[model samples]
Target: MATDTTTFKHVSYLWDEAKAAELAGDEVALLIYRSNLLGADLRLTNYGGGNTSCKATAKDPLTGEDTEVMWVKGSGGDLGTLKRSGLAALYVDKLRSLKNVYRGLEHEDEMVELFNHCIYDLNSKAPSIDTPLHGFLPFKHIDHLHPDAAIAIAAAKDGKKITEELFGGTIGWVPWQKPGFELGLMLKQCLDENPGIRGIMLGSHGLFTWGDTAYESYLNTLEVIEKCAEYIEQNLGKKGPVFGGEKIQSLPKEERLSKAASLAPVLRGFCSSNVKMIGHFTDDDRVLQYINSNDLERLAPLGTSCPDHFLRTKISPLVLNLGTDENLDDVAAVKEKIAPLFADYRKMYEEYYSTCKHPNSPAIRDANPVIIIYPGVGMFAFAKDKQTARVAAEFYTNAINVMRGAEAISEYTSLPRQEAFNIEYWLLEEAKLQRMPKPKPLSGRIALITGSGGGIGKAIAKKFAAEGACVIINDINQERIEATTEEFQEAFGKDSTAAVTLNVTDAPSIEAALANTALAFGGVDIIVNNAGISISKSITEHSIEEWDRLYDILVKGQFMVSKEAVKIMRKQDIGGDIINIVSKNSIVAGPNNAGYGSAKAAQAHLSRLLSAELGGDKIRVNTVNPDAVISDSNIWAGGWAEGRAKAYGITVAELPAYYAKRTLMNEIILPDDIANACFVFVSGLLNKSTGNILNVDGGVAQAFVR
Candidate 1:
């Protein structure tokens, strides 16, 4: 029978009898189905925070005898995305036998390597640290989750007392212990001592529930969380004004976001001192409620209670209390104070490491805080990439929920300082970090390419994204922006790129685009001034309006975009690249192209000027000159092809062959060829050289830089 959805109030009941029935009898499949359901709701477990397992009888290959085997989630796998291949299958007897060789708590880490010997299936995924916790339980089905409500109770000052009162001896309690063989033994001992307990609350950790079948375990996990959520909700309603009432009024929506945009670049720069970092900003109601509250100062440094939470958010966030109450109007003034505070934070982090370091501690990592809180604004999370930064922000948000619940019932408690450090710099964790795939050259870089709807701009965006840079696809048409954004989102991840509609000649539009880029991925590190329009006509035939339009797009557009982008790059204090896609007409001086050719010449000179001016700030500006790029070009589609063909005494369709023949190398230029030239400048190959022009005109001697 299907579980009645109406019984559950705090959490969603997504289990469908018909759907689950399809996966029945296949125990591993049922385990995956149950895990997916639990993980589907963040209320149950945040991303990659929990694990589930089932013990089933499988055929032993060597003896062809049926043996009990444990299939548990592998290290680093998310429960929601769990698959058969994601589970590490091990022989139950082999895992149980390791208890004989266990050398006590001091040498627990060695158990990790021993786990490999217990594999029931060849080529199985690596088992998680919590593998023994499930393997020794002796339950047919088990669930371990980090549900916020349960964690709130777990992290509460009176967590044990509350558990005894709430469940009345049905749920047992275990003191805070870092995950390892020791904790697993502690869990087993608790189950043995409390013979009738339905579950266990892992103090300062999470919850553990079990049952004789998959359905029972899933139902028990949900019921426990739902009951806890109900209790938290009741207590919260009784308590007036969470976090001792809001200390600072939240800025209005538009004003709040505008402030976030203004401050993000500066903060991003400070955080990237060690390595390039991406930033994520959230003004979610929960974040504002906490940061704007009086207790923010106290709780911000206390840090997160859950291991998963601190692993992502770091031990503590750096809270900035800019002098003014709520008015952050003087952004420059506020920015000035941020640097010294950040320096203090770095010093404090280093001190913590030095004090906590053991003989075998891993070297200190980036001393900068992963999370930064501005009371009236919101929270900003920084990491090595967009998705990681976003996830860290989410983990901090979960910590906020836990804190709210714990405070409503009892005082909220963070993990002890030594414990937090132990987990943060664990040798096993250091090994995992070392095992990660090497980062791509442009891994942490963010690029904004204008006129990327199609043509050279689109090609450049693709190449940069492929090389691991997050891209912002900008175009004048909304449809093109949507299409390109969707395509990039599919190819890369949703976090890998964003889209903006822009008209570069308009200053306000340019500012809005830059702001959007800041909100999307901290700030822009590479600017490709590719937005352009071509008008091919004789000087006498060209209307003044045509000439102005050409200049507005090709020349002034590049100037405006560069002008705005440089401001952000300067605030970031990180060197950046600006690549302008000019045309060979700038120097070759082709006929019937007066307006286009003059604008191209102006654009080329602008690159040189900016290269000279911004060199002090380490900003490199370069230009790429491509001639007769007729294939997949918006310029050719808009009557430029016809005009150019007329000037060259050929039909529109003959332009490609005719233009190619005119080049010294007889090579026809494609949009990708121009994109390659842009990469050459931004790929760090020409780091020292600037104020130069590279001609991509199939070796056109006349267009060569003199």
Candidate 2:
């Protein structure tokens, strides 16, 4: 469908050189920048709508030589802040070869094969359905936008003529075509016809442009859309009649009217216009005359501004004319009329499909409209969910505006129906549906672990990496950090983990660590605050330095990491899980742990407070209080267990068994146990269980029996 030119002019691009540098190289930075440009343009038309891609050369595994690869934006990724991992890389040659095979394969089966052939870059996520289009383009950089200004014009009568006049011969125009295979073919044809054209404008669809470089492609897109917006603004005002003055259509019941009223806010939210009910009879003659016009049929094929938007809005809105003497307030009557109309629409879709399909190439798709825009009444953009609905409404609103303006010139035109169908049902477009190994339950998921070089921290880091998460292992000891990273690389492939030597007490170190983590893993999805220092001196004898060190590592470190992790998590829309490793001293104080006990106690309270405050964003913060666990690092070298045993006058040999016997299992607990507990805390099973402490110390500390 046509996009709104006005909306295109207001589109903004998001770019950050620092973020680009963090991504590792200029090539990735360029990709992110171009993706953001496309994202901004699509957002102007439909929130979270559209996809973009880049084709580059990568070393092939089989030949060990450079081969073409398509780097496409992943599904469900927000383009505004997309990172390198947000893109999925697939072999471009493989996808291009599929175009030559015209066996009329089932879309779903072919999709599976395409996905099977798809290869994920070490960092990127799964590619979007539009990956094939990127492969189809000859240029290195490609941009696809569902621009409101363009869709608006494409959706109106004489849309093609308007596009030709406004954009002229420099821009190739393709008729309305479904977005996958058909659109690809139409685009190919346009390229063949106008080899020198800068871009192709899809009538009743969107726009496609490419360049040799990311910047060039992005700038070209901006320039073209800006021109389109200027043309629309100069020719036609982007305003519609206010719905407030429309006569209210009388329904059989008040409830029916109420339902319509309820929908008004939603419509107004998108259209930014007041809603009023125009009774079928107040201006019966005018309403009927308008409905009876042949233009109604002509507008039917305008379809959706883009095909993916179909998931949000239905195909089209029903044309309704209220009858005189009908009950003006009956909700049931309204439902009755609407329900039957959907059935009729379904039947009509089937008939259309049957008429259009060729014996050798015919295939059927679900009979659902992307959106329905009522002529007199405000439009109802329906999607499978609210998110989709919002996206559809945005695209529809812009498309309508463009259509209205284009009608000023000539009858808007679109690609043939069959062409649109091919694009909508192209095998390449369905590739994303293929099943792959479920991301290691944590793939694309990030975890920041403190004290990750030793004991529980190391265990947790390795465990998370084994489970498919990219781990950011943090510790104060440089040696431990490097050693732990080495151990993790040995256990889980080297590419799965990163190590950062960060002193928890240092703010700059913490910030740098977080920045590095974001660059390495895109963003953190989980934080395990396991770093802490313990002192055994009595409160009166303990030095201020010792106390401060304890608090800094246990309390301040957790705070700093949590704060930064939460910021990234919130922006990424995946609420993170923060598990603080507190001691049983926080729940049960003892005689000689003034410094350690106080710090642990503060950490526990901090966890509780963060849980309460961040719960609104769905972030789960909790404490894991373990009584005591014997580890090589913690027992032999002035570790907590060794110090406590010395204070109790116990032998090192007896200390391990003594603590084990104190627990119900009488089994010595390893660091892996604590790591496993942390894993459980971050998993979905504990998604709703936060703000409380989980005691994983066997039976040393009983719940509610301190």
Candidate 3:
């Protein structure tokens, strides 16, 4: 459906000659520009999947003589966001000289270590394994991209024949080979056999294009991809409904999304058995069409053809065979059936690993599937972080497009199981995994802090996000939400936090907010009931309306929020934490504070009640009681400071000193102090404790728990 009506579809020519001229003389700059343009379109390549390079003559720092250097994207760098610093510069002559040491296929991996010796700049980033692929090519500029359209032709059963027919030998074909020195040599051999070919289609892999200039290579790559997409589109137009027509009708939009949200937590739980995982859900038309089609059963089990796709989505996806006839709303029933489905999938994966693993293969990683396809609903992807989960889903979508194009022209052919295993368990890949930095304490956890627009709520949100938790900052004030969201985005990445408007006292509002949170970052793992209101008046001065407002926000608000969050936590089947931001007044009685004190008392008791009731489910409910947090507190800003100052027979400015002098430690309390106490409960330090109250009032003895 995305095909171009006339000249192009699936991709576009986005080159800007005006921009290109700005960096005309700098080869690395031009390479970055070209790579960015190609990466801008997912149809061209998935994130961090492809590599680009250019050969340029530069001054050798050591010899002070002009030498040809190859600048290529460094290991683990993404093209779209690449900077000059992300490139690895290696001496072209030194790379070429390695041919004498190359001992053939068996010693290919050893060459990776040798690449370090060819480094033209000592400060350059580590070279990618694909360095040899670019080094062995004779062209000044080259691009190896995994475009779905190009890969479709490469993944077909008769791919080699199709390549000859599509480009009439202008584009050559090479049989399937794992990337290394051996594959690089195979490419050189192919070029030797066909001298005039514009590019080479690496079987069951991707396409490689080259040109004497950066602009030329950029154009040639786009042109070849466009041609392949057009040919596939024409063939698809003549074919029947994709994947042998839809076998099941998709659910209505609202129902479908609700079902996805309901199931995401359960799936996340299943996937996190080995380690916690964040989740992503998508119901894009392509995914829906594939999952609802007749061929899903056959094609999904065959697994992804491309290595990039295989790496992200694992060897195969687990397809859930739920039908429209089932009760979509009965999440509990669906939950019961899904466990065995996941069990069966893990069993199959173990069998696959056992069948194909070599003696040197790395120990099996988690057997849980990274991707799960639910018929009539959509696809779900889980990973150790939010971005990876989302990107995994995107990569799988690319796989779906490849399948559609390959099936339209020729029967889709997946990589052989043994080959897929080799890549999945490659020692180089294991080393890459081992090199990753240790995950943060709160990595993969999602936290929702109510009233996070300012004050104590904001502090908790910042702390959680800094600890690597994806935070949902909830408040009724849209303006404050936007401001705080922007601030967090600048500090942590945009994906690290989401903002939502919520009124915890209102049931529908609470439901909508939680649903949105689930949609934003899968589901809730922690809830900080920090939303509150205060009316510091005596029993006689406090009107019924004022009393109700205080109770509504302080007592009922917390109960409603915790009630909704627990549902998600229970479904997740993972233990969770709920921290209530109660006040010291909850225990120590004081004058002219009837409404505020009673509401705090109710909230504190509610926390204890929930802790007792929810202990069976491994959901901890704890309380943080603070006496006075005058700084950055909206409660103090809104006349409560004056009321408290009057009660203590002091000025508003003296309120801080008054509250601090009364404490045993004689220390003033701050919002961050309260946040720290909350952290102590949810930070896994107190994972086994529940129904506990951590007072953060600078040691207020009167407010201490008995």
Candidate 4:
């Protein structure tokens, strides 16, 4: 490569002193602030794609003297929301000392074992694989990120020459090398050659920048990345459609959901190259454009631009045999082609492994496609679980962004098969996977809660989410649906759950919502049939219209939802759980409430019949009956309370206290109390439990079951 001295550079910094002040002086606090700031910009990195670290002084364990320590981002920490506890601190001197006794290639696994044993504080955490890189560097702070602009420059054919001209000798370059003790040694060599170098660009890898202070490190990264961005913008110049001659593959989510759901099971089975696998669908504008483009068949198979992306994305994705017009009618065709697809993909992967297997590298992981792109319909990521699947999705998204920017400048180029294999099979990245926490009991399950606006249903949604279930907040009110959806996403994650506007009584609406949930979350695992309406009227005074409306929303609604869920669950061949949130009046007679009592009674009976019939299929059915949940119930606020108050010859204001006193324990049931019993039925904690009625009425003898 020829070194040129003339290159135009333009870079800017977004620094806020107030933001820095928010994080106290603690080393972890400063690191957290820096990590969040770097992660805030998708242009810098996306999701869990970057890492940050700092060196500080800490009290020694054996002696009272102070010693140097390195606090690096640990294995499972997310950069965007990094906290003080997310950082793991280790003895800087001790970590670098491992290089002396470390055997060349075979010792990589032992090196990581020793790295964990050198923690400065036992209470700290298991240090990350890249801990040695940061510890070996003689800097207070270090940052490594997969920025789009930087990655585009690093993967280019003329990366070395362009970087030399752009940095003006202020930054050094390290050619593509696998990450480990060797890579750390190479970076140390770059620093020794170029004293006071701002950063180093790794070919087809990531960029590493360090500084005496966190602010300096952050600023240098921003400026250097901005310069790369400028170079691409200047050279790429005017461009045609990023999708080549193809148009955006924008399709209505509803139009494609049912088809996606119907075919997800087949694809999931085919792509599963291990003991377990999950499928997730995503149709982000960019994703759709990439998979549906005319150039997809040519460019997508090229591979990832960054080595760090290999662990999550693998060397190449398994492109399904569907095009822009993929539909459910093709299930038979898909089923026929799926076997050969897997056979061919595995054959290719086996060939690659045999051809490119390095003596030092570990055996190739299962040759499954972590990513699957189906033109028009959208893209799906297959992983061991939902969280890992989301990570693959984020990696794929970043890969496209880099390619889009790079191809415009020249051609999108990435690491070849051999280098990709090294990183994918690296023991360091493998250790990260082995260290992941066990899945929660409800992991990979989906729960749909009706009347979830603000009541017992909403409480159930929140509780199920805590147990690792993806929640679908279904309600007729758009405002409530939006609010509840935001709350679910905040509690879980952006992709953990979805919300749909639905009227339970409407068959089409219920079908659409079920399809939406199935498409987004794969399929339903738990159905909480809690949506209903209450009308307080004496049997003689209640009109036929009242009975019809109550049954329509309560009895028929639950039936429709359960019927739809059973179909999907049966097809999944994975037994499911169904919980019906019935009223205490279902069995216990209540005064002046014939309509609600009769509907709830029918619902409770319906659950028993369904339980008896579905038990053969391994589906559990149960009911939770609560008496008076006075707080946050829409039925109470929607005039049912006032009517009941009038029946008791009391004001609505006095009804709550009266109901509280009526309970034997004087305990007014809250929405969460009902939520607790509802989750018991939904969680399958009682695997043998079926046709059981759990009550939540604070010891009301009339509501007690036999």
Q: Tell me, by lDDT, which candidate is best.
A: 1
Off by over 4 Å in 3: 1-8, 328-332
Per-residue lDDT of candidate 2, residues 583-675 (tens digit): 778877677788888888899999999999999878999888776667743524555565677666797678877778878877777788888
RMSD of each: 1.8, 14.9, 2.2, 5.0
Compose the digit string of candidate 3's lDDT tens values, residues 1-706: 2223245555767888899999989888999999998889899999988999999899988779999999999999788888889999999889878889999887788888999999988888899888988998889999999999999999999999999988888999999998888888889989999998899999989999999999889878888998899889899836688899989889999988877777778788888899888888899999999999999999998998889888999989998867756674566887788889998999999999999988888999999998999898889898998889889999999999999999999989999999999889988888899999999889989999999998999999999998889999879999999999999999998778888899988999998888878877788899999999877777887899988988999899998999999988988888899999998999999989999998999999999999999999999999988888888988875578878878888998788888889888999988899888887887878899999888888888888788
486 Cα displacement, candidate 4 (Å): 5.1
By lDDT, the better pick of 1 and 2 is 1
Candidate 4 is scored at a TM of 0.82
For each candidate, the alpha-carbon lDDT, in order, equals 0.90, 0.63, 0.89, 0.79
lDDT of 4 at 328: 56
Model 4 C-alpha lDDT per residue in residues 1-706, reported as the tens digit of each score: 1112133243324456887877657767777788887888777877777789999888897998999988888766678888777778888888888888978854666677788778876776577667777878899999989887888878877777778888888878999877667778788999999997889998877799988888878777877887778777776536676748464455677655656777666665565436335568887887877887777888778889696676788778877775546555554666676678778878888888888887766766788677887776777887766777877888888788777767776677888887787677666666666767777767777788888876888999888888878788878989988988888787788777788888888988987887777677667778989998788977888889988999999999999989988876665556779999887899888689888898899999999999999998788999998887889887775568877987899998898788888878888899999888877776656988999999888878888777
| Candidates in descending TM-score order | 1, 3, 4, 2
Off by over 4 Å in 1: 1-4, 237-240, 323-332
TM-scores for all candidates: the values are: 0.97, 0.47, 0.97, 0.82
Clashes of 4: 0
Clashing pairs in 4: none
